[model samples]
Target chain A: MSDGLSILLSDVDVGPRRHPFLRVDHLQAAAGECVGIIGPNGAGKTTLLKLCCGLIRPNRGTVLLDDRPVGGWRGWRGWQGRRIGYIPQQTEYNSHLPFSLRDVVAMGRNALKPALRPLDGADFEAVDHWIAEMGLHDRRHQTFRSLSGGQQQKALIARAMVAAPRLVVLDEPAANLDTRSRWQLRDIMERLFRDRAMTVLLVSHDVEFLPGACERLLLLRRGRIETDGPRDEVLASPSAADVLAEI
Target chain B: MMDAYFIPILIAGAFAGLSIGLLSVFIVGMRMPFIGSCISHAAMVGAVYASLFQVNPTLGALVLSILAAAGVAFIHPHRRHFDANTGQAILLAFMMGLVFLAVALEEGSRTEMLGLLWGSILFADWGTVVVTGGLAVLLVAFVIAFEKELKAVLFSRSLAAVTSAATEPVYLAFLCFCGLILAVNLKAVGGLLIFSLLVCPAAAAYQVCRGYRSVLLAATGFGAMATTLGFLGSYVFNLPTGACTVIVGTLIFGACSLVRRALAISE
Candidate 1:
């Protein structure tokens, strides 16, 4: 509660069809900590991130970000642009949607302003910067459907980061990338995090891809954190063995 | 082959071209072509009641259409609880019931009951033309102004809701707009035949266009084309203009589908 990088979840519950899909009794990710959430498939790792992002409200408890209830934090677009960046798992975007890579990336900026005005000079610069950063300059003008898996994943990351949010929540970003692309992303994330004081909540099953990039870890099992500590400590814990076995 | 009735047919074709084009685009994007059909058919019941009550049949149609649209929205039957199909079914049934009621109320002027079935583009007067034309123009302008916002809804309703877009009100407005258009154009197109104008062009456009904007534009174009060609074909063959227009649209959709398939195979 006293920490500057603050996220507080108290008795949170999320579900589908009134079934207990996820439950978090209490947890906090203080500022400047890249907390890695590792869990089995359907373990509600993504659900937890969704709660923090205010994309889904808890059925029971409160989700507070920076000492304020998540719902009370107005203007999701403004908050996303300035405070939170979300990179969802790669999926087939609607092919019928005509947004170019640049347009998709610009959505990140739009989420910040929620206005109908044109993207200004500064917005263009941010987009260009992130496009280069993600190594997606070549595909910037291409239709989103035309990009390869790795290229699309990079583009998604660039889109998430274009607003330069303080906290970037990446959900299985490396899920669809090749080993080389994954490493490239890791390096890019390292460089980006170094340039600014940022918090990253990365949800992934691939623990190896993250330990070097993340500062801390929260291992989730059946919707509860079984282990949470520094990267090395949690990685070496018995829960890690259990996590690996489950995976 | 140009009869004295050519002027009336021409005017109906023109107005139908614009309004049907706009309607088809909405039908295509919302992926609810059946809803358009259901609404039009249900409007028939409303039109019948209005005729029986000696009131403006179009107004009755509009009210009923809006009610039907709301009913459809409320009874959303998908596991997601938002799909429009079940509501469409309900609407279709309601329209049939209205037709039955209208048949019972036909104590005299049975031809009037038949009027709702086989429409007369030739009987359209200057007032009807003006109203239909204005509605068409208004529909086109509304689509142009709200294209992006509409596209966002088509992309994802949840995303639209999250992004400060009043999606429910927009959706309701669209349905109401559709109702108004249906009511105005009911005389020229006939409720039984309006579904063709609403579905054919948009379905064709969706077969080829990759973007929603282009699909809308193309659907509008195809709608106009179908109406014009159908009118001409109807005149030459001594056929029903409304039904012929729909037939023309279906043919165009078939052609587009063939072209799409050939291109896919070639690729």
Candidate 2:
């Protein structure tokens, strides 16, 4: 309770079967920390991230952000906004609607305002600042769908950052980018980590793609944490070789 | 006598178009054109059945439409396996069966029921104008209120629910609002015309428009124009207003397709 910018999960288990899809006995990410979650496909890496973000609730235990439950079905005016910014992987955003990059990013401010009020000038200012920071000012007027994979990721980053969250959760942010785009994203993450005070939980398959800030790495296997420790120490462990090879 | 019918019908047309046009943007943007057809058909079943029971058809239609709109959500155990369209399809077939059964069971003259089937601009009155107009205003207010929430949820409900508490409520409210609009417009536009109005105008606008606001305005304008054209075509040529409205909407979509092609625009 009253932990500054932290996420804590206790006895979290997902699914109804004897073997839950995801199970976490206890996990906590402290303030200003970058934790990389790496695992093979279907290892429930994404599920764990969802539980942490409060997107999906567990059948067994609790996930708390700071002192409050994640979202917890809190009202729009509650502590939902300005708290956690989540960029989902495989977003269903490939529609024909004409949302410009700026328009898409501005949604990050939704939690800050009530349902009836529109985004004010300061909101747009923040949206613009993040878009510019991502080096996407030229493409701000373009449709988000038209952007390349890398550009979309950058736009998503801008979207998440616009909220000025205390905690940010990104799932496979650089999953399908080109090598150059991947490196650019790594640099961007490094810069963001250096600049912002927010805690970040990143999920990715490639260890090289995990930003320099991921001093901690969580190696998940079969829906559970196989190894959790320092980035190099976890990778150096003998058990990590088999799981990391699956990547 | 002519003035009394003409004024209210015109008002209803405008407001109905405004409301349905705005809602079209939401459904079309989210690739759920089935919602309009499903609700309209569901309303038809309620209207016909209510007429048999000596109840207000609009009230019955509204209730049923909301039920149909929420039909897919009830399959909790199988929600993961059943997408929205699958749920809609199942409910739609059931509603169709009820519509036929209601017609078969009715004994007397089916004047009100028949009016709901093909529409009766002749039956247009002041009550129709008030309901449609109120719905149009509510829809506008809703859009203003939930712009960000809509953007987030429309893109991905799963994604938005992650961070926003308003996601599920906003989405459920949208589905219910759409039902109410369809129910109110059921008598005036009928199922077929209203379905076309829901899909064609917004789909056409997307062909030529490049932004959310522009598409919304364009869809609203096209919808209003289609309704006015329907009125004029019926008045001048003595055609059925509902059929005329459908033709105009279809033509607008066809013409927009051409315009987009002429301008070499991509999806």
Candidate 3:
């Protein structure tokens, strides 16, 4: 309903047992903010993003998106929870089902439809518009798996946008892409921010992966946030460069 | 083909093939071919148990397979202690062991048991025709009604749910329908070869088809043609219908493979 999502994480602790311990005593991102999350490999950045996306539950505390519970009680992601568009790491999808890029992008409307309803002309129009927006119209008929990694990543971004999400979260979108493709993605990322006043959360090891719109940075290490401030201020932290290099 | 007695069987074969052909796409796409094997064995276990109680084995087969399918569909893969394939293999072996035990303990005639385990299309009655036709219609209708949602879950159920697609109930219902369809056909197609019908045609379609709709249409067409030919095989050669159906399906796969190879060479 709002132009963007306002996120709040309060006293959140996840998987203190079988997995690495992740705790966020307090964190908040206002509407339309571009926040970059960078941390070491074991820093629980993915876990934190998963929490924000309602993919996992916190053991100790709650995540609130726009003042509503991140994921509803008893593991139901309510309307508020559904407004967040999440593109997980590429490796997370275990199976490739040979869907065309067009069909795959159309899946963004899936979360918005009722149970028995098929996507309509309007949905396809949105899909086509985003496909053209992402410059993937020529290859819309190609199987998603047949594309290059950057192309697939672009398709995923298009997939996230079709839902008209208030918050868009991507985890390592440019991880395995070539230098040229990564730079291309950076342009798209900047364009995405410039076109919409929506919240964006990007998790990447490469600081340069963050778009120029990224105004704030959170440096995480060993499941803890060491620096949470403006991009320049966090980058200016004495330990930020060393930690970023190690991860 | 127009004979009064043979009409029901011909209708049953076409409808059954149509439904099974559609399900094969999901099974193949999920990369869980083992689930089919497990369901067939589960149906066998149910059949043997029904024989133990002097009841019609079809009833038991339907109930047991549906129950087993629920476990496979409803439980999240990550929640399990082991891999999905491993769990299915374990379930299949356990069902096989149970089938043997039930067979050993029972003193009833083996005729009904054999009929269920090795289905004969010639014995298909109007009742079977109705059940099979109903399942086929339901599967087709479900696919149409839930096209977008079904595509999402097929792509990846978790991703669909995370994106806020109401995939859980739809996915569970899809699996329920698939289980029911497979069980209903078990009496006419045999427990062993039922899985072939559910996988072979769809897999063959993948060799040339570019999209989901194409595969669905092609698989169903292949299935209908194979079933018709198989019926003729029974009439002409007096061989087992299931074996004939499997032979035709294998031929289809082989031809498709050749087509793929030829296309590759040309390219």
Candidate 4:
């Protein structure tokens, strides 16, 4: 009911077959809220994240972003800029592709600007800031596939954040990262939420990787949200231990 | 050192080489080198049908190639029954079958039919030169104009779709461009040899280049070099022009691979 809600999903069903693969009756995220989505494998966490970002539409339901329907927002050019940011579970980059760390990060700015236009000074500055923030300045010129797993994750994070989006959706971003990188990722998410009031939807099977700023928790089970409430309440619930065990 | 006849041949070869070389980077980069093969065979089917109907082979080739490319695009990547690559393969086989049928049905001189199959770059006319040159220029201009969009799609199509709304249109346009280039150059390179020209140069460049722009430049340079050298070799050895060109391209790719191996060992 809040006018400041960043995302709203109502009666959503996704996937083929007589029985939908994933269904969400109702879900809402207010502006500046960091919602951690934790679920076991096959619980449709990634699908829920994709639905939020309009990468996959629901078979039946209305999804809204900032008071506008996602279908309409999808029509706008550079919709990711200042609106939605998504870092998929897999980066989907080809090893043969000659994209460098800087090039990957620059794509964020290019997504905002018109095609064929070169990056201006402000764009470069923003890119530099994110690269430095992600501690990737040393490897900025290296081919993306040449970097370590942690470095690649950081670069993808920088790419997702470079546009200063209103909502950031990350699907299992820390899955392949090491312990140090996972902690660093949590720190980055916390900083972004604290300093910029950036709304975040972090999907992960690992609960420890969730940022400290994540106040809301949604536990997905078999394509449905079995528990949705404040992080502490969800954690203290009787089924929380079972969910942790399932993961 | 070029003679009057050799000059037109070289020019046509260069135009087709440059255009195909540049586009090949995308084909190879996207890991869909078979797309070139698919579109070229579709063009071949078009040319055969045109010959049977007494129509413009170039127009027929373009139309059929576009339809084939679009068909590949229409197949969903997540289809349970048929994937995009499988769909392309089916289309290619169907087109190739139709081409042979059309050739068999024709009662005229088989020389023309063989020309479509094997190509005759040595006998290229002013018309071939003009069409190839115009298409080369158009392809170059398109790459320049949509460089970012193309890069985005090349990097990742689904990611590009999420970032920019122009991904689908740009992707379809890219496929259409592939069809156009294949159709226009069908006579010079022949359907059978065009795939090698479209992939070998780019694959060779990819072996050495560390950046995307460098790969594009190197691929185009390698394609032109191979085509010219192959033409000279064909002229001196009295061999098929298309076969000679493809052989040169394969040699370049093999040499580049060896160089890459040597560099990797030294490092």
Best by TM-score: 4
Who is ahead in TM-score, 1 or 3? 3
lDDT of 3 by residue, A164-233 (tens): 8889998999998999999999999999987788999999998987888998999999898888999999
| Model 3, docking class | acceptable
The sequence of per-residue lDDT tens digits that candidate 3 reaches over residues B1-267 is 357888888889888778888888877777678777778778777877887897887788889988988877745653344677888888878887887788667676777666666678887889988888888888888988888877877777667767763677778788778778877787777877777887788888888777889888888887876777787788689898887887887788788889888887220
Q: Write the per-residue lDDT of candidate 1 for residues A1-247, one digit (tens) a residue.
A: 2122368899888776366668888888877667888999878898788777666677788887776666533533234323566776543234345556776676666445533344578888898888887878877777776677777777777866776666778888888678898888778777766566677788889888774658788888877788889888998998889987897
User: Which residue ranges in model 1 land beyond 4 Å of their true spot?
Assistant: A1-8, A16-18, A30-33, A53-55, A64-86, A89-92, A112-129, A166-169, A176-200, A223-229, B1-57, B64-124, B159-199, B206-213, B260-267
- On lDDT, the stronger of 2 and 4 is 4
| Clash counts for all predictions | 1, 0, 2, 0
| lDDT by residue for model 4 (A176-242), tens | 7788888888888788777777778999888888887888999988888889999999999988888
lDDT of 2: 0.80
Isolated chain A: TM-score per model?
Answer: 0.89, 0.93, 0.94, 0.92
| lDDT, candidate 1, at B97 | 79
Which pairs of residues collide in candidate 2?
none
Q: Where's the lowest-lDDT run of ten residues in candidate 1 chain B?
A: B74-83
How good is model 1 by TM-score?
0.76
Candidate 1 lDDT at B11 equals 73
- Looking at model 1, residue B55 earns an lDDT score of 90
* Residue B202 displacement (Å), model 1: 3.7
Residues B1-267 of candidate 2 have per-residue lDDT tens digits of 345658888778877777887888888887777777888889999888888999989888998898877763343221243576766667677777888788788899776677787775656678878778888888888887788888887676665665567767788888889899989888878865688889888988988998888988999888888887887788789998888888998899999999999989853
The CAPRI classification for model 4 reads as: acceptable
State residue A221's C-alpha deviation in candidate 4, in Å: 2.5
**Which pairs in model 1 have colliding backbones?**
A5-A31
